[model samples]
Target: MKACDVCGKKSIIQKSGAHRYGGGWAMRATKKRKVWEPNLHSVKVTHDGVRKTMRLCTKCLRRVKAEMAKKVAKKVEKPAKGLHFCFNKSIQFF
Candidate 1:
């Protein structure tokens, strides 16, 4: 079986946890209220005699866990010059 290139661990089970939508929508509108997310953890797994460990980020290790990381990254990096999106426009919400 192929092993992890970076961690040298075997195939890992991609563990994921809850990620509230728009920070539960309250944070999006009020910007003061804070929604909570749990710590996401990736654990090693051995199934049917196969062994592996899923690679995870530091956020999963400590910070608020989220199921969607890449999508968040993209949204956070949206350029100010990009297409102006009206509030009513159907945005591709992560």
Candidate 2:
């Protein structure tokens, strides 16, 4: 029973119907049990200066990647400490 490490996603059991061809009014509809598993992928991630391998579902993986990208973009967008950024504003005297 493999599951995602980040989200703890696991397999689910469900009932499914059998295929019916043409006009099969006399044929009975058979029900069967089906197993639905999450799409898990093995990925390596670095956190807190430590590298680890984990199994992550598609949704979690996408979220983690997006967060990492945001961090990188934020770092790039930051201005230097000595520089001041002033937006356009009208002069006000009080």
TM-score for each candidate, following the candidate numbering: 0.20, 0.64
User: What's the C-alpha lDDT at position 51 in model 2?
Assistant: 97
Which lDDT values do the candidates have, in the order given? Answer: 0.48, 0.83
- Superposed by TM-score, candidate 1 places the C-alpha of residue 49 at a distance from the truth, in angstroms, of 1.7
lDDT of 1 by residue, 1-94 (tens): 4343334434344433444675665444533333333333466645489987765444443322353465588688655554566678954432
**True-vs-predicted CA distance for residue 43, candidate 1, Å:** 1.7
Write down the TM-score for model 2. 0.64
Which regions of candidate 2 fall more than 4 Å away from where they truly are?
Answer: 17-31, 78-94
Best by TM-score: 2
Q: Assess candidate 1 and give its lDDT.
A: 0.48
* Model 1 residue pairs with clashes: 10-52, 11-52, 11-53, 12-53, 12-54
Q: Which residue pairs in candidate 2 collide?
A: none
